[model samples]
Target: MNKAALILALVAAPALAEPDAHALERLVKQDCGSCHGLTLKGGLGPDIRAQALAHYEAAALQAVILDGVPGTPMPPWRPLLTDEEAAWIAEYLLDGDRE
Candidate 1:
């Protein structure tokens, strides 16, 4: 391929850095797996997959992560997780669904 074509291809290529599932899993396991399953199917907590985070807006996801669901085993993580970390977890699950 020509130098110009190679350069264009490199530029147009999709982002190669997809989020890491293992790292996400580790975070979920450490933070959520005690209640939710290690795989995020279910445990003491309700099935997060069934909840379908894809349906939720980023704001809604943030609310749940930060404030936690009421009348459930899910507990508010405001003190435990910074807003940025919570947002990352929410986006990871909503966008990646590594489980």
Candidate 2:
């Protein structure tokens, strides 16, 4: 492949490397679990179970995941995730599907 093509491929690699279910599950169980509880039942943060999240809109939850709750322990994950990833996480949480 040409140098320019190689460069383009490299640039596109990260965007293509979206997390899979296993990775997402690990993130939730490890990272989010730190605050939300290992089972996401409730911890320092509020419970984020599917039923608990029923009152929240999916978009609103995605916004919270991306931007975080201001003046709270929740920190914005925008830097660490794409909008799609945030939406995925929000949907995952709402679906109550845990690996």
Candidate 3:
């Protein structure tokens, strides 16, 4: 393949991976909860409960998850999660039904 083709392949955005709900729940409870608090209430981080996060649209929440807030303890999770996974997390956070 040509160098240009190879570069495109390397940079081309992948389709969002199918999410694993159970695993993602565990990730939220463990990874995100480490800062947001085990119950998603305020801890080292601000409250992330659904009510507290109501102002954030899903896309906005996804960006925060993937890119994190600058100059804050909220570190970027792009390396650890796919776009879809981050989106799923955003939905989960927004969903009142979530545990």
Please give the CA lDDT of all the candidate structures: 0.71, 0.88, 0.90
Query: Higher TM-score: candidate 1 or 2?
Result: 2
What is the per-residue lDDT of model 2 for residues 2-57, given as tens digits with 9 covering 90 to 100?
Answer: 99999997998786567576777789889999999999989999999999999989
Q: Which stretches of candidate 3 lie over 4 Å from their true place?
A: 1-16
Task: List pairs with backbone clashes in candidate 3.
Answer: none
**Candidate 1 lDDT over residue span 20-79, tens digit each:** 546655878777877877767778886666355568887788789889888977889887
Runs off by more than 4 Å, candidate 1: 1-25, 97-99
- Estimated TM-score per prediction? 0.64, 0.81, 0.82
Q: Which ten residues in a row have the lowest lDDT in candidate 1?
A: 12-21
How do the residues 40-92 of candidate 3 rate in per-residue lDDT, one tens digit apiece?
99799999999999999999999999999999999999998988999999999
Better of 1 and 2 by lDDT: 2
Off by over 4 Å in 2: 1-10, 13-19
> What's the lDDT for residue 64 in model 1?
92
Best by TM-score: 3
Candidate 2, overall lDDT? Answer: 0.88
